[model samples]
Every structure is written in C-alpha cells, then in structure tokens.
Target: MLKQIANLDQNSGNTFKLLTDETGCCGDSITPCKYVAAVPVANSVSAVVVKDRDGNNQTVTFAAAATTVKAIRDALVTAVNSVGYEDDGNVLPGISVETVSTNKVVTIVGELIVVSLTTSGGSVAATATCTEVGICEFYVEWGGGASKVLTVNGVNATLGDLTFATASAANVKSALEGAANWPSGAVATVVKNTDDSIFEITVTNAQSTVAFILDGLRLTRSNCIVDYV
Candidate 1:
C-alpha cells in the first residue's frame, strides 16, 4: 500500500538549480524532482602585428580581418620614405626612382671616358737628325662597328711615318699642345712608366672607334682597339 507524488521549481536566472530524490514518503509512497542545467556562449576576436625591415620588432598592430594587403603596402612605403635613403640625407643629386607598373627601377645618367691609350709617344727626327720636337696632330678612328673620328690637335704635323723629316721630341710635344682643331671629347695626357715613355689619349666612347689614323709628315694607322663586345 504505497503512494507517489512529484514537484518542480523554476529559477529567475539563465541557469537552473537541480534537485532529485527517489524515496517513499509513506509506507510505500515516493516523490521525484528534476532541474535543468545552463551553458555559456563566448565570442572571439582576431588581430595582427606589423614589423620593420630589420625584423627587430613590430611598429604597429592591426585588427586581423580589418587590414588589407594594399593598406599594408602603403604603410611600408611611407615608412621607407620617412626613414630616407640609406638612413642618410646626403644622397647624390640627379638620381631618381621610377616605377613601371609592378616593376620599380632606378636610373642614373652620367658621363665617363671608356676608351684609353696605353702607348702613344715615339721618337721622330728631322733631316735624319734628332731634333727636339713635339707631336703636332693626332687623329683617332673608330675600329668597332660604329664610324667615328677624333682629332687631338689642330696644327698640321706628321705621325708614325719616318719617311719625312723625323720630328724631334720638342716638335711632337708642341703639336699636342698647339693643335687648333683638337676635339674636346677626350683628354690627352703624358704618362711615363718605369720601363718606357708614352702618351695616353682617353676616348669618351670605347666602342665608337676602331683605330687611330695619325696624319702629319707621314700617314700611319695603328690598331688601338682595346675592348669590343
């Protein structure tokens, strides 16, 4: 002779306190109880860090999903410009940066002498007698594919030819200094080595000339092409 009864309770919060029991209240009676459990929901956020070229440390931080590649590239460019060239303000003039689409190039325009003479001076005589003379005129011709001519002096003289009166050292020297039509494209200098004495003429363009044609008392051509490609 047993009897059973059940009861339930509700709470105000999202969570519920549970209570359970299984027993006979009277001789054979039982009461049952039950409750609900609660769970929590969480939200996650993402972020990123930006670093310098040296990789030493990050200079800035950004929201991960909010940042774009274009924005990051612009930031890098700004940082580079602010840092300046080589970390020094003494960058040379006439140098500029050019951008071609996705390609970046740097161009530098300058003038430099490419062709040079190693040996030029030789002994000349007048009337079979050695006299003090200098070089009067020196002409150089293009030996490479390009056709070009260069005159080192203006005065009328002879070179590389002994058939005429041998020019003295003084005559040769005077000719080099007194040429009226000398081309200003290059510079002519005298260099004395330990073993030999010679004159050097440096040409502005090496590939433009093939050989030098000396026209004076005698006409002679010497192969002066040092490099060709």
Candidate 2:
C-alpha cells in the first residue's frame, strides 16, 4: 500500500504497506465484515480459535472467573496481539484486535477470522471474509542518482531492492520477475508502460487483495518511489 506522501490524515492513505497473503480476503460476502466477531461469553472455561498469519489455529484461554466486559476485552486484545507481536516476537503476522465504545458498551472491533467460541449455553462465532483476487501490482518511479539503491519492503535488489542508476522498463521487469520477491505467490508478468521507465509491475496470486503489512515501516529509499492508487 503505497499511499500519499503529504496528506492531512496520516492513516487515511499516507502509509507504506506490504503484502502478506496474496489469496487473503478483501471484505467480500464469503467472509464476514471486520469487527463482526461475537462478543465472548465466559463459561467453565472460555476460548476463541483464530487463524494466525500462517493459517495456523491459535487458541487463547481465559479463566472462568474473568467475567467483566473490560476483563474480556482486555484479555482478548492482549491475547490476540500477543500471539503476533509478543509471543512470536513479531516473527508471525498477528490478528489486529481493536475496541469501540458507545455510552458504556464496548464492542470488539477488528478483522479477525474467528473459528469458534464456547459459552455456558452453547457456542457463538464470527465468520471471516475474503475477496476473490489473483493479481498484485506495483507502481514505481525511481528518482535519478548514481548507484541508486531502492529498498521496497526488505529485498534490496531489482524491483524491490534494486540498485540502479537509470534503467529502462525492461530492466525493472527482469529484476522484479527474476527475483520473485512478491507477497507469498509467484510473479506472472512485468509490463513496461509508455513512459518506458517501469510504470507498473503486476503479480498474480490466488488470494484476493494480498493482505498483510511488511515487518516494519522502515524503507531504505534512495531512489524508489511508490505511487498510491
């Protein structure tokens, strides 16, 4: 997600993002909307099974004594985030859990792929959603310089981490395609636009919108530029 450079709102779009699962969901019917997970109800023991970045089932358990809304919310948030950030040490992609409050009622808000949850009565659940997509595109403009080194995400080679002073579209195509440094899927084709400066780099993936943010907000940008759509 190569967003705006200068904008009033930072989170609006002026952010640098990376792709994780090229076949992931994108707010479609097949998957439920974000923040739609059922509110957890405590039982003799309560747990929610969620899919992690690697499509692995991770279970977070809570004691039966923890019954307050805040207790549940805090525990859930901490547990979900901890798997991705703390326990995994940010090595794995973790589910993002958030909260929204109105008056005094707090709602668990986030894009979590809920599997199942147990309660005193029976069970409750929230469904996950994903869009049907198969392509990932990158629009880049290399600023002119000598021995220009551009780093996209992490791979510092052609396309992603390419070290080039001035190269043609063909040069860029080979770099990105040959490197195969894309989300999780492989590369399909590298097209050269009319400008002949590598206008767009298209990637093909089964997972729709190519969801997932890069490891960090860090980018060693010397001449690489991202054009937001």
lDDT of each: 0.26, 0.39
Q: How far is candidate 2 from the true structure (C-alpha RMSD, Å)?
A: 18.6
Q: Tell me the TM-score of each prediction against the true structure.
A: 0.20, 0.30
lDDT at 186, model 2: 42
How far residue 214's Cα lies from its native spot in candidate 2, in Å, is 47
Number of the top TM-score candidate: 2
Give the alpha carbon lDDT tens digit for every residue of 1-229 in model 2: 1011122233423234222222254632123223234443333226666666457877777544234555555565555544432222221122333333421122232334556554454455654433323344433333322333334445543234333334555665555445444444444344445454433444443133333222222211122221111
Indicate the worst ten consecutive residues by lDDT in candidate 2. 1-10
Off by over 4 Å in 1: 1-178, 200-211, 215-229
| Best model number under lDDT | 2
